[model samples]
Target: MSDTSKPWNSPMPEPQFDLMRRILSAPSPVGLEGAMTYGVLKPHFESFAPAEWKLQQFMGHAGVVLDTHPGRDDLFKVMIIGHADKIRMQVRSIGDDGKIWINTDAFLPNVLIGHEVTLFSEDPGAQGSYRRIDGGTVEALGAIHFSDPAQRSGEKGIKKEQIYLDLQIHGENKKQQVENLGVRPGDSIIFNRPIRHGFSPDTFYGAYLDNGLGCFVTAEVARLIAEAGGTEQVRVLFTIASYEEIGRFGSRVMAGEMRPDAIIAVDVNHDYVAAPGIGDRRMQPLEMGKGFTMSVGAIASEQLNRIIETTARVQDIPMQRDIVGPDTGTDGMAGVLAAVDCVATSIGFPIRNMHTISETGYTKDVLAAIHAITHTVQALDALPDPHREFRDNHPRLDQAGALEHQGSEKPETADK
Candidate 1:
């Protein structure tokens, strides 16, 4: 093996330790239930023209109450205010049995009565529940129903097909109560709770960490750049793409929209921590506690390689390079093809057992990525025109080729 101990072997210094410390301290773990909840609630929160009255009404009937805990009072308040501003409510009804019904007609259109649904609550105080409905889309004839918790335990883990919503309302005749409330079949059922966080002194986990980490890192970079009085010639689009896992939909749309001169896609690379298929040559050789990996391959741009290498040299940042054969299978591929003159690269962290409920990464890797990306942006701003340099440096390639051709003609005859 070649000596990997050059000056470049030194770990790059990252300044975002504090921010990453806080991030790792915060909880967000991804799972099937969380993903489903995100699909239901994401639209409500991300919509520009939010449905306010509808949301307030739903909260009113769902008996959504807000309470603050000691250390996280402000966090809870912000979350409440934010959720309230997004979801619109169509129906809020109370049942004789004291069950509550809250409906948002426009949020989900394909909902059917008796379809099993899982309910996630936004408030930490609310106990997340799962339920089933008796009738749906029948207009005044439908009743929201609840599943027995005992029965749920016996069944294999929550099945999406078997779940249904019990909009808590009871009537002697279900039709009469539904009619009074104006509930419809196609109305979306919002998962009640924000994805919760599980935190320890050493680990933080929650939903939406796939690209959420990217979002967090980019935002911090932007803040740092602004604070450092960097010039804003390069328009840095800190994109929080949606639907990436499904089909790279958000990145596809974003690449077209930005059409940037260059793109550096930051995504997680597999970390082989627990299991053993991954090897240093195949995936990232990066260790959990080591640092970030700067990949080189068909997807990486020559321009980007030059900048990153130069930056690493000047900054004394530790970086490792690996060959990504044909395609990186990252958003970088999309962005590179979209622009007239585009170069793409990826900075990755070692994430173990990706696409599972409990994907893991090191705090150190996250910090290293932040450092690498920030320096990369700075390097891009300072880089001289590479095309011009290439033309000047290699002016006589054609002449050299012809001379080599002439020399080759005399070499073939030699029996002597």
Candidate 2:
């Protein structure tokens, strides 16, 4: 397209890399999300939310849902899916010498031996409940520097069991000091890597891009939709599904809660991460700067994919199609099983080094994804009978001839 044409199509504000960085820096490690991350992310959700949009937190789960579905007889529901959690370790025990023994649900790379980290604990500061308290620099045993350097063995292949943290205060009365301050087992520990400026200004290097970027993008989609006074035809819902890393807890908890017409999900994928099999941008299936990865799976709605593909072209956003999964290793599958027979599909964002402190994402591609989702949401309003294509091809019954879809039909949208 010519330079003049580009300006006309690009109407949205520059994607907020800052917002993505903010969430990325905050720690929302798996099951510990409510204790560490929910409060951190709540402010952002409140700030960007429009008056018509209703933001609600699910205590049973560790994430938030922003509802924009209108109160009407005929309503189309679209869920923009993303997880709001990351990988981290926990304090299993506090040694008498002021050392903290850690345990993790996820496999953290041994390369973390020499990295700095933050310890999150609870304190009832004036408030009636346990508030977040900084526990200071996490001192790992095998780190680069030790007080007596020559005494070190230059260890290799460190395991989580062998690791320990230095709480600084030690010797007699050590356990008492830590215990009195509410430093107990089960507190979360996360790497101390702040969101840093990447190779270029537009690029970002931070923790939790796997879904921090996903969460940010989901919120951005909601913000864009809400700004336009919500979609006329489809009542759009941008959901930050939590605990996706460890078998999708958020998706399961909230699944079938609302029987939407279709479900759409996105997460930073491994397709474009710096890898050998993926090479040459032109030949790559899904690479950075190539746009979003449109995954085609059995559970994914074919009609939704068609609509996304059409919207991508119209918006001049490049999209790569992947034919892989009976279960796409994403929230889409969980959503599929949960909601009787809602159409399920996903978009994969390109990023490097998932499950690391310094995951990398291209700003241009991230912004492009936001546009693609925004355009698809916009198209839902303009498209007539968007659900027909998927419905016609949808499964009618099982081998035993029982109806595939049997549940509470939509009484009305949330607003009603």
Q: Which candidate's lDDT is highest?
A: 2
Query: What lDDT tens digits, residue by residue, belong to model 1 across residues 283-370?
Result: 5455555566666887676656677777765565555665678876556665654543455677666665443334566555665566
Local distance difference test values of all predictions, in order: 0.44, 0.69
User: In angstroms, how far off is 169's CA in candidate 2?
Assistant: 3.7
Question: How far off is residue 371 in model 2, in Å?
Answer: 0.6
* Candidate 2, lDDT over the whole model: 0.69
> lDDT by residue for model 2 over 1-416, one digit each (tens)?
56344422333234455566677776777766663236655676677776776766777777777778535426777777888777777888978777677775564645455556677676645433444444444445544564244435544545568666665686688878878778678777777776766776556677767777777778778777777777777877667777788787687666667566777778887644466555664444566656678888667777788889998877677677866457777877756567556777878777777766677777767777787888888887787765675667654446445557667776575332
List candidate 1 segments past 4 Å from native. 1-204, 276-284, 336-340, 386-416
Best by TM-score: 2
Model 1 error, position 415 (Å) = 51
What's the CA error at residue 11 for candidate 1, in Å? 15
Ten-residue stretch with the least lDDT total in model 1:
76-85
Question: Model 1: how far is 324 from its true place, Å?
Answer: 3.5
Predicted structure 1, TM vs. truth:
0.50
